[model samples]
Every structure is written in structure tokens, then in C-alpha cells.
Target: MKADRIVSVIFILIALVFWSQTFGLQYNCSIFPHLILIFLILSSAIMFAQTFFAKDIKREHLSGKDLKYIIISIAIVFVWIYMLDFLGFIVSSVICLSILTLILDQKRPMPVRTLSSVAIYTLMVLVFWFIFHKFLLVPLPTGYLI
Candidate 1:
């Protein structure tokens, strides 16, 4: 199968799984996920259909280094998720976002740039936390350091 088709199928499956889980949530909590899942499924289905009609698609092989980075990125995300309960959403998000940004940037890291990135991530995380925890009245994972 083509890569696009495979990705679409995978996303469709993921959407279905999440869709099922959403039923257990209260109506207010489930609404956003339902909308997002619907978008995911529709976009993936559209991509799958386009893959069938499109010809001469170029396939690029991932290099070993690129594959290594991808694997590491996935591992980092898993670790971030695991850390959330212990570190809280804000701390975990800032740490993970900074690490991910550093990993993806190929240029030599400067002290100023690193600090700026950390500050930016911190601000972003705080904004999101405020929106969800304060404005939306949604409870986020809280731990010792929050």
C-alpha cells in the first residue's frame, strides 16, 4: 500500500479508538475530542482517496539518522506523558517542548537562544494551563512542582 494510504488508515483506526473512548466522557468534555476526531477521520479519508487517484507519487526512504531521530522523538513524547502526573502539565510541557526544540535544531545551541526557547515554552505552557485550568474550569494533571 502507498504511504499516504497507510497513514490515512492508521489515523482512521486511531480516530475510531478515540471515538469509542469519547462516549464515556461527559458531553461537555467529549465535544472537542469528537470534533477533532471527526476532522482527523475526514482528512485521512480524503487523503486515502486522493492517493488512489494520484499517479507518479515519489517515495523517499528515511535515512538511518532520520529514523533514529524519529524513534527518539517518539520516546521523548512517551516519557513526557509519563512525567505529566509527577511533574504537572506546565512543568512537563515546558521541559518536553524545550528538549524537542533543541533536538530538532541542527545549529549549535547558544546560551541566549536556549534561554529564550525555554522562556517561550514556559510562556506558552502557562497560557495553555491558564486557559484550561482557570478559564475552561478543566482539571489538569497536578503534581508536586505545579
Candidate 2:
């Protein structure tokens, strides 16, 4: 499909740009990003190839509800990035995660569900905090409260 080809080309270009940028970074900083970029490029290329070779496609379309959910999820990530410097990583991450969880599982009661979501996300954040700070020796962003 035209859309698939376009997306594949765009991803290839983006991967190339990122690959070029990685060359300017220090070895330690560039290694992981380079690895991920290479993986992305290879996967995109393989997918594009498969698109050409595929016998048939179901041509399933995204529902309006699904599209809205995608937009909301993307918006949450952008807002989380913007809030990171001001609110710090832990707080922003937990808040973003809780919100996404609530959005994803809206069938449950709001009050009880919200609290459970927050608790789950808080535990997740703590685990990440420990891994990043202690094991990886990477510093986490800390706001006034933390």
C-alpha cells in the first residue's frame, strides 16, 4: 500500500538521521542508541519488504475510539515530557502512568480504580528508581518533594 511505503520510507530516513547523530556522541552514550536505531532500520526494512511480498492484507481500519485512545496516549506522553523538568521524573512518570492505566481500564469504578492504578504505578516507579539509581548508577530527576 502507498501508506505503508510512505511510512517505511519516513522511518528509514528518521533512522538514518538518528544514526548520523549517534556518530557525534561519546562511545558510551552512543552504543545503546546505535543498537536500537539499527534494530529499527532492519525491522522497518523487513516489514516494507513483506508488504511487497504479502499474498493479501486484511485492510483492517482503526476505529474512532481506538484512534482517540492513540491520540490521548500520545498527548499524555508529550505532556509528561514537558512536565518532567518542572515536576521531576518520578512524579511526572507516576502521574502519566496512572492516567494511562485509568484511560485503558475505564470499566471499573473510578475512585477505587484510580487508587489501585496509582499504587501499581508507584511501585513500578520505585522499582525503576532503584534500578536506575543503584544498579545502573544513573541519577534520576528529583523535584522538591522527592
Candidate 3:
């Protein structure tokens, strides 16, 4: 099997296991995860099947630098989740989103670019905060200090 086929098959297995695990959740909580997992399973099956028919198709691969940056971004998101309760949603999200935006932009005039990205994401986070807390009636984490 080609590398792409192997990866697709692995992900299909993973999605099956993940979808199955959602069955243990309460009915209300399980519904969203079920939808997402089913989507993943279907997409993976399509990819795996395409691998056999699309041998002539060119496959795109990420450069080592891009792969490294992608891995680092994933780590940052996991860390952001772990720290959310301790640092609070607003503060931790600001930091993480700012960093992610800057990483993706990487333009000239370093200070200006950094500041613009930070400002934009901060505003975005604030809008989400208002929507979730005010309209949706969901309470967000407020850290000990904040």
C-alpha cells in the first residue's frame, strides 16, 4: 500500500474508535461528537478509496519547515487548553491566538505586523466572549488573578 493509503486506513480506524467512545457520553453531550466523528470516518474512507484510483494524481507534501511549524502550532493549542482554567479563557486565548496569527503572517515591519495580528485576534476573542457569555448564557473561566 502507498503511504497515503496507509495513513487513510489508520485514520479510518481511529475515527471508528473515536466515534465508538462517544457512545459512553450522555445523550446531549454525545450528539456533536458523533456528528464530527462520522464526518471524519466518511472523509477518511473516501480518501482511502481514492488512493487506488488516483495513482496518476500528484500529491502535495509539506516542507520540513512547514511540518515543524504545524507541529508547534498543535502543541501550543493543547497547552492553551490545559492552561485555560488557570489563566482564564480571555487571557490564554489572547496569547495563543496572537502567536498563531503572527506565525501564519510572518510579514515585514515586524513590530507593526505583530501588533496588528494581536489586535485583530484580541477583538475576535472579545466578540466570542460577549456572544458566549451574554447571548448563549455560558460562563467562561475567570482565573484566580483576573
**TM per prediction:** 0.72, 0.70, 0.66
Clashing pairs in 1: none
| CA RMSD of all predictions | 3.4, 3.2, 3.7
Off by over 4 Å in 2: 21-29, 55-71, 82-87, 110-116
Arranged by TM-score with the best first, the candidates are 1, 2, 3
lDDT of 1 by residue, 12-122 (tens): 999999999988899999999999999999999999999878886667899999998899899999999999999999999999989998998899999999999999999
- Residues 1-146, candidate 2, lDDT per residue (tens digit)? 66777888899999999898887789899989988998989988987898788766677799999999999999999998888788887899999998888787758757886897799889999899999988999987776556
Error of 1 at 93 (Å): 1.6
Judging by lDDT, tell me the better candidate of 1 and 2.
Answer: 1
| Candidate 1 vs. true structure, TM-score | 0.72
Pick out the ten consecutive residues of candidate 3 with the lowest summed lDDT.
100-109
Q: Between which residue pairs do clashes occur in model 3? A: none
Give the number of the best model, judged by lDDT.
1
Question: What is the lDDT, from 0 to 100, of the residue 56 in candidate 2?
Answer: 68
- Model 2: pairs clashing at backbone N, Cα or C within 3 Å: none
In candidate 3, what are the lDDT values of residues 33-54, reduced to their tens digit? 8888888888988888887787
